[model samples]
Target: MAARTAPAQPAPAQPAPIASAVRRDTADAARWPDVARLPAAQPVRTAIARHLVGRALHRLSLLEPDGAPAGATAGPVLTLHDPQAFYLRIARHGLTGFGESYMAGEWDSNDLPGALTVLAAHADTLVPAPLRRLRPLWAAARPGQDRNTPQGARRNIHRHYDLSNDLFAAFLDPTLTYSSALFTAFPARFDSLAQAQHRKIDRLLDLARVEEGTRLLEIGTGWGELALRAAARGATVTTVTLSAEQADLARNRIRAAGLADRVEVQLRDYREVRGRYDAVVSVEMIEAVGCEYWPDYFTALRRALAPGGRIALQAITMGHQQMLNTASTHTFISKYIFPGGLIPSRRAITEHADAAGLRTTADDGYAEHYAETLRLWRQRFTTNKDAVTALGFDPVFQRMWEFYLAYCEAGFRSRYLDVRQLLLTEGTRR
Candidate 1:
């Protein structure tokens, strides 16, 4: 046999791009670049390589559309995996670049959560390498886009929820319940997640003392699940949501259910709602309102409820009083995920409620239930991944959603997050 050529030596990996020079491009240009240009930062590149390689080396490859090895560098590395493009912005401008580049389709990935896990796991390397200088700049820039402001809230709500009604419908249950924890009462009986959600609705209605012909007000009515359930129970319900898609779908669902006579959904802000009802219920919506608004939120509920009317509020609360490192997680969510959302502590909520002339009649912590709920959601989402992609959600969105569900599940399981249902009355009920 002819002497075999020595096994070809593997080519040396390229470096990452400099964080400052990553230019913003149009969506199309971002999606299918002929070559990837990276920063000259060697240490950052090495760190990124270590992170990526540590996760799943077999699945990792850098290539152009033609399958040729493409050049990649640190500073701001761009990855093109087809149908998704991701720009790793490693500088102060990187945050804006990351968000805008994704919107522009600058890079793609088949595995979003895995990519994030790699990045997050090596956060010490990924962050603080060159982005710390922007802290003061970002802090100064924050007030302008805060959730309490109308522009910020509207921007955030539109960015995520307004992506598409069809997309949400693909993953969400028929009722479109988007929030936290479904209390199944008897955990063993409800074999399906949807059925568990239905049971949770029943429990909430029972707790609210909802009766036939009773008027109900729902704040942040995601997909109108609770409102629909209340209407089915013979209660007249009015639900409000900031998402246009949610409002439209909820309206159609009500009509389809032939409950239009009693159920109405409005695309409106919670602060803007005005009316008195027999009962007011808010689910998983309080987090979107910053703690600065907690007093206002409770006061709004008091004003919205008729005397002796009951109010039910369900929300995710952290166990601690001080802000934790997870504050960065919240920041990322606000910047990329929920926008203008803030989870409050148990103390903050109860104290603010009492201050706002409302008494907490009952406080139920259903931490385990929420953990189970998230587990079910994550499983369903993963099992239906192909269907979800078919609905036009990109890999980044998929990753974000997966991380959201898994992180939430882990949080509840670890008591890092708590699910709370507080029954409130305008004043002490005689």
Candidate 2:
């Protein structure tokens, strides 16, 4: 997860043309757009919406309060405010419109996770059969500027991760982990978030076979937690990150932990890394590599491995067919939260790593753990709204972040998305 920054400081008065251009860029790049003034729906549109929502919920085994299962408590289900407009928007813009409608408060549910779980389970069947083929016309095109070129990567990363670190600290546990955490056996209390995060990092380290005197390279350094842990295991850790805030804080943390000599924190891109190591671990970093550059990213990791070295990767993934369907489309999460990021499929990883001469040694899925992790983060964030606002985030930004967290949580809960820890060795070595 990258940091999300608001305008750093107010600008001095500027020339009219220059001011206009700046405003255009900021507005065009915004993930939240104006929807409060959506056009009124026609009578025919309302009729179509009633039928569509009724049939869809029925198929999903969910019941609206208007039609709750007899004698059964009203379980989670969609509750529409402006039914006509909500349906019309989905009919027009497909998935993008569905998300925006949520932002606009056109519909709401007290049981968001449960409601979304149902929707996620029936994602492919949401649209009518006849209208499905028209999906190409409704899906948003991926923006060219969102590509992960060196220059573009810097801009996108800065937009989120270069924001105030204090803002992120407000919600995350003391470990400063921003990725999926491996929780203890299910049905546990929320107090175990930090412990779960440590367990997750340790598992990755073990998977990579990091041991005493090992040279370990970590591609994404999220505040240096992993680096610190590796150094404590007698491993020399070299960790790289594009976030200036993260690097500065991570270095301070390392030095404070008295492990600076064993850990090297660098402000560099993954493509620029050059050394070989006994173990390499990248956590949730592949999503940011962009689909187009996956080959190069994996190739770089392969080249950076010494003889018999193993690479451990923790990645967020989707089903292969879903990945194929969304590969060319833009999503609200990308627009607002993680620009240029795309969750890969396990199949995609297998194929790409094979092409890079890396053979998979192990693959483990922990999608349920991610759901628990997000649920905890969302709770912490919601409880600390004042702290977030103190960091200069507005109401809209807050809502966007909440939605992003809940959206991801639902994906995992429904088994529509997953997080995996993968171990890979050079094809010849294995």
Candidate 3:
């Protein structure tokens, strides 16, 4: 969104230093240490995890220590340099720990997205029935303080969005847009990304019917890309964002685009928005509004919407069951990347909208495009590693971003994740 094989396979006869390679002791990188420096799992638990992981290698090969294959496999090869640490990490924290192991240099794959797609395809079957029954005892719930209260929301936004504009600039296109771009074609050339981003933004504006003299409101202004485009279409935009860094950069970008009078970038929360808007648009910000706050979020949108106004949103989606499964559980994304983010399902989106007096008028799903988008981003990110490092991000941070991008790409490729553009208007059922 985000490798090393630095750890060695310790001899069984000697004690193991499982946490040695995984520790983020860099003084410069203190901001993003690994989530909850994991303790080693009990031997029996480690053995059971090792058994399950080995059993789950249907679509990929797991290369254990000494270059031995975990099983007969046919897809990407996951090479494990520190098999003990990797297995024990999975044993301790399951999926979160698996991601931590990767961030810590425990395992790696030449084709990370391919490997991750394999895992995503087998996610349901990875843990056997008996072990699945025991998940409640082993799984950890999300931390309470990570809730999405007005104050808590700002803290969550800052953790990820405030990382650095320079850091984001290293990977994103010139527009600095972070959500899925609606590509005109698949396997699109890098040169065309900015165009694709404009295409995506323009579509949302069109769905909202933004036009000359339209009073537009954009929730989650992503560096002013949408606002600039909206202003160009003669719509006056009042965009809001919680990240101070984003607000400053967005205002500067809008001013430079000569759209300052047409677009207003506010360092404000959606809850604090006042007055009514003729058109409303939000891109990928719903994910950051935790499920618990979705009602309040949609209500705020409805309150801002004037009569005959339309609302458009681009949301990353998951299966309803999957959303329920992880609603209260902590995952790798929630832990290391976004503190309180939770992607909603399409069903949840419409239900909440309807409850807030909004009716669905259009639905468009194009997750395959998102996979390509992530692929392009990861390509640029990997190419600009030196620049990223120059920005003071640690090697582990680089790998974390690598893993995140690949992981999300795999989710889309495997149909485990989805992205949609939804159009809604105030209406009652016929």
Candidate whose TM-score is highest = 3
Per-model C-alpha lDDT, please? 0.61, 0.78, 0.82
Which segments of model 1 are wrong by more than 4 Å?
Answer: 1-143, 181-190, 322-330, 428-430
User: For model 3, which pairs clash?
Assistant: 1-404, 1-405, 2-401, 2-402, 2-403, 2-404, 2-405
Cα TM-score of candidate 3: 0.90
Residues 1-430, model 1: lDDT tens digits: 1111122222112112111222333213443232133324456534554344333322332222234344432121235432222323323224333444443345433333333333433444444435444444443233346656555666777877888776666656666666554543423234466766776676667778898988999988777778888998899998988888788878887898899999888877777889899999898888877766777788888889987889888878984433333343334456556776778888778778888788888877776677566655665676677787788765555645665665455466555677887788876434
lDDT of 3 by residue, 267-323 (tens): 899999999999999999999999999999999999999999999999999999889
| lDDT score of residue 344 within candidate 1 | 84
lDDT, candidate 2, 1-430, per-residue tens: 1111122222112111100111211332254443444435556755665578668876775655465554354556565676666777765555566766666666666566666777887888876877667667767888999999988888888888888888889779999999988865553353488898998898899898898999999999989999999999999999999999999999999999999999999999999999899999999999988999999899989999999999999999999988988888888778777889889999999999998999987888878788778877777887788898888876556656666777887798788998989999989333
Which candidate, 1 or 3, would have the higher lDDT against the true structure? 3
Pairs of colliding residues, candidate 2: 3-160, 3-161
Question: After superposition, which runs of candidate 2 have C-alpha atoms over 4 Å from their true positions?
Answer: 1-31, 36-54, 58-73, 428-430
lDDT of 1: 0.61
- By summed lDDT, the worst window of 10 consecutive residues in model 3 runs over 1-10
